[model samples]
Target: MVSKALIQEISQLEADFCSALSDPTRLLIIYSLADKPHNVTELTNELDIIQPTISRHLKTLRDRGLVYTVRNGSSITYHLGDKRLTQALDLLRAVMRDRLKHRASLAKETKATINA
Candidate 1:
């Protein structure tokens, strides 16, 4: 059994995870990194975002332990720190799909009722 303090810590960690994903640019970065490791320059070129912005997001991900980096000569390449990140992304996609479908169905029902 988990203590109250442990539960609070877990909740905070979940909040941090969601916070890290709140930015669309950051999400894109994570998805990009999911495919393969990339250096800051490569990521900046691929994302079309400024180097500082990419570095900021990368710092947040690193601080949260969501990504791991290694030095390749003078460049640092980043990769997903956990295999479970893919599973979590898959779960989130499924939930978003279900919610979107539900909203569309509701809108269709509302339109039909108004036309009836």
Candidate 2:
């Protein structure tokens, strides 16, 4: 039920947009935005990152279309463009957890065989 063209399009979007998520700080920003919107100052203070770093991360997120902003008075609040992004991240985390457990089990088996 999947088409090659659709896959190509999705692949391009992933390359262009998801690249921003490759940074740990950006991932943290996404997770943090899931709870509530935050301005640059709040994010910098909460994440213990410098102001310039947070601003740079936010710029990347905005460029990637992963985040957006709302102007309020003299401040801007950054929001996740979609809630499903967090769900996708959670699914990836679960997959990673399973892979880790599988690797641990294999290591244990190997150790037992070596000791035998």
Candidate 3:
């Protein structure tokens, strides 16, 4: 029931989403914003990244629809727009943990073979 144009649009959006997450700084920004809203200054202090860098990454997340901002007087607080983002990050972390465990097992087996 999907038209070619719709499929193309979905593909483009997927690519954009992946591109948005391609940077480690952006991923960290997403993770930080997942818990609560924060302004650039707070994010900079918590992430230990420079203000400009935090702003740049936040802009990328905003563009990708992963975050939204609320203006309170002079401070603009950024919050996660979708909770699914945190779920996705959690799944990724689980996969990474599994991979690490597998690698450790392989390393142990290799060491045993070497010693044998």
Candidate 4:
């Protein structure tokens, strides 16, 4: 059985980390950084988002400890805080795909029933 304190910790972490990921643009940024670190300009070009928007999302990610930055001369590059972040995202995507497939099958069954 899980302890109440553990559940509370999980809740706090979810609030901290998952809230940062609530935006699709942020998710795209995460995916973009999975390959390699990038500065704001590079992320803007890669994700086709405006530099300001990318900076805003990056700040959110940085605040959540989801990404870390390194400085090279005047440029600052962001890297994923942990590789497992992408793995977790991939797992969520798989779950979403499974849910959609299930819903499609249910819809097909309902349509067939109506026709019958």
Q: Highest TM-score: which candidate?
A: 1
Q: Rate the local accuracy (lDDT) of all candidates.
A: 0.92, 0.93, 0.91, 0.93
Score candidate 3 by TM-score against the native.
Answer: 0.88
lDDT of 4 by residue, 1-116 (tens): 99999999999999888998789999999988998899988999988999999999999999999999999889899999999999989999999999999999999999999999
> Please, what are the lDDT tens digits per residue for candidate 2 over residues 1-116?
99999999999988888788789999999999999999988999999999999999999999878899999888899999999899989999999999999999999999999999
TM-score of each: 0.91, 0.88, 0.88, 0.89
lDDT minimum window of 10 residues, candidate 2: 13-22
Clashing pairs in 4: none
Candidate 1 residue-wise lDDT, 1-116, digit = tens: 88999999999989998798889888898999999999999999999999999999999999999998999999999998887887898899999999999999999999999999
- Flag the better candidate by lDDT, 2 or 3: 2
RMSD of each: 1.4, 2.3, 1.8, 2.0
Q: Could you tell me which residue pairs clash in candidate 2?
A: none
Q: Which is the winner by lDDT between candidate 3 and candidate 4?
A: 4
Cα lDDT of model 3 by residue, 15-113, tens digit: 998899889998888888887888989999999999989998888889888899999889999999999888988998899999999999999999999
